[model samples]
Target: MDYLLTCDCGRKHTVSRKQADQLIECSCGQSLRVPTLRGLAKLPPATEGADSPPGDTAASTISKNGENPWSGWRGPCMAAACGGLIVSLAFASWYLLQRVSIDTSYTTEMEIAEGNKIFDLYTPEDMSLVWHSFESLGIGAKEPPLFIRWNRYAEDRARRASIAGGIAAACGIAAAGIWLSSRRRV
Candidate 1:
């Protein structure tokens, strides 16, 4: 269904039967005149798996074995990148929500601690009273058990989100590279 039209510059263009008697531009800036329909039938057919010109569709860039080199992994790599991004967003949102909840809890505890007279004293002499007040309010420990557990869960989610995001970034880069390479080859 296609014919090889060679230009004066020695570049061959694969033209369809419908393009007979039409003018086509070669990559070397030469305008090639396609043969008539009858003349085209005499010309050699465009070889399958031949190197296609730039801007051609993916199907035109098949190799001698009748397979597109980038077809196998390119699609899967992009899909993986998308999947990773979704996972990262889900984990990140969960972590952010948990962080806000933890912050609110901490603020409430701080407000309660601020209401103590020892806190209002604000003097070195009342340091022991401050400690006693904090102990009485159950705020003396470095972190509450509930807060520790929540913080640990949030940290774990954040870590997972970061790892997923990194994987997505890597996959995206790889896919882009493969796409660029395929384009260059074409």
Candidate 2:
């Protein structure tokens, strides 16, 4: 049969009576005068100033040692693959902006050159005819004839390509912004 053993610290443990001889101490913070099956088995109730029961001390120690088990650090998405994608899209937008500027410059240069050519191609007599044609075409007095054709090399297919690329780059940047905003775990 199991015999109950009690420590002076008010901890209760069970052991066979044959093994009780090894046990000592009581809840009153007093050591046993004799460690025997009879000496350790039963003790009087708590006196004063004994340490809290061994179990309470053990629990406190365990909690203190454990600290916060959930504490951990999280990483940022800005440092990962999505961050590189954002940079790539930003570069694409810059590339498109440069193209747009080039296209505007080239278009302006071509129009200026064509205006000069149109002036050079006229004579006093031809100017009267052209102005009359402009009126017939419903163009204002200050405007040239709509049918007039002037050519300049700068306003070519390459300039059109630049405008197209700029539009496409703008779409790409929009797509990147959507993706970044929609994503989580950053």
Candidate 3:
């Protein structure tokens, strides 16, 4: 339930029982102290149509029913969605860095020619088998064939990560708009 607390400037504030004995700032810059629970009970209860003083946006957001608009699932859902957005963007950045690193690795003309020859000789399925075999034998990134394959794999993962990040960003924006609109309803 809410109670009406009158300020010295003649502005009335509809405050909740939880705000008992707390200091509340009035719109006129006056710091009014809410009465204690016993004193508060003696004051008049806020009517259903009681309006907060002008320019009090914080109070305006509270509905007549006394329930906070952002309460319950809305707050938690928004937090989780924002967290997902951050994680998605972080993964996208990491993948993009991996792609750039792989692309800039040193490769001589002779190595390129040898890599092209190996690439042309094997189908994708056969290349995967050969690459795995070479990988297991400790043929590292410096190898022409392995370097080419690793570069391609990194590029693919980067593209997928960026797409996921974009979707997450869109979702996060939409959720924020919805949450704000819900809060503004009074």
Candidate 4:
């Protein structure tokens, strides 16, 4: 029979009749003297394993031999899932915020060169070069001035990062789900 022993800390402990005179260790690490037969009679009987200490549950994912059904695979899977998710988010954020700039400079030494002489110098977003022609600056135009082109590189970076992050996060989430589902509770 299980005797319900109330500890000094106000925690109820369940002890077997065989341990009535023994000193039982409570969850609080305090030594409790098992109640005598008369005292046990006064207190109600607790359900077997109902009030057992933490990690000592009769019904759990762990077996009676102190082994989890997952065989230690759950913990690592959880950690990987979490790490992947975090990395994915971080990469995605970084990709979104990343912006690269491309700059091009042109200088014309020609005496009749016009600023418009330099055309099709830069490749367009589609990788196509646009050509330009300058027939007349009326004949003797000055050399073309230096030209610079600026574009945002953020778009590409953001796209890559977002894709990578999303993929990673998805893998992490899937692993986490698998790990959780693989666990069996008794």
The prediction achieving the highest lDDT against the true structure is: 3
lDDT of 1 by residue, 1-186 (tens): 877777777777777766778776777877777799999998888886444444344345665465676678766766676676666667666665655565424444664676665466678667877678878887644754565576677677667657656765776676677667665554
* Candidate 4 lDDT over residue span 73-130, tens digit each: 6667767777777878777766656533323233334412553354334446422322
Model 3 C-alpha lDDT per residue in residues 1-186, reported as the tens digit of each score: 778888877877887777778787887888888889999988898875665654355577566576667686676777777888787778878777776766536456767788789799999999899879998887655644666677678769778778877967876896787678776775
Give candidate 1's root-mean-square deviation (CA, Å): 9.0
- Candidate 2, residues 55-112, lDDT tens digits: the string is 3322222223343222322123323334545555565555555444442333445667
The 10 consecutive residues of candidate 2 with the worst lDDT sum are 68-77
Q: In candidate 4, residue 71 scores what lDDT?
A: 59
The clash count of every prediction, one per candidate, is 0, 3, 0, 5
Better structure of 1 and 2 per TM-score: 1
Better of 2 and 3 by TM-score: 3
How do the predictions measure up, each by TM-score?
A: 0.43, 0.26, 0.50, 0.39
Instruction: Assess the local accuracy of residue 58 in candidate 4 as a C-alpha lDDT between 0 and 100.
Output: 33
lDDT of each: 0.66, 0.46, 0.75, 0.60
Tell me how candidate 3 scores on lDDT: 0.75
What lDDT score is found at residue 183 in candidate 3? Answer: 65
lDDT of 4 at 127: 29
Off-target runs (Cα >4 Å) in candidate 2 are 1-81, 84-113, 140-186
Model 3 misplaced regions, further than 4 Å = 1-5, 8-53, 56-60, 104-144
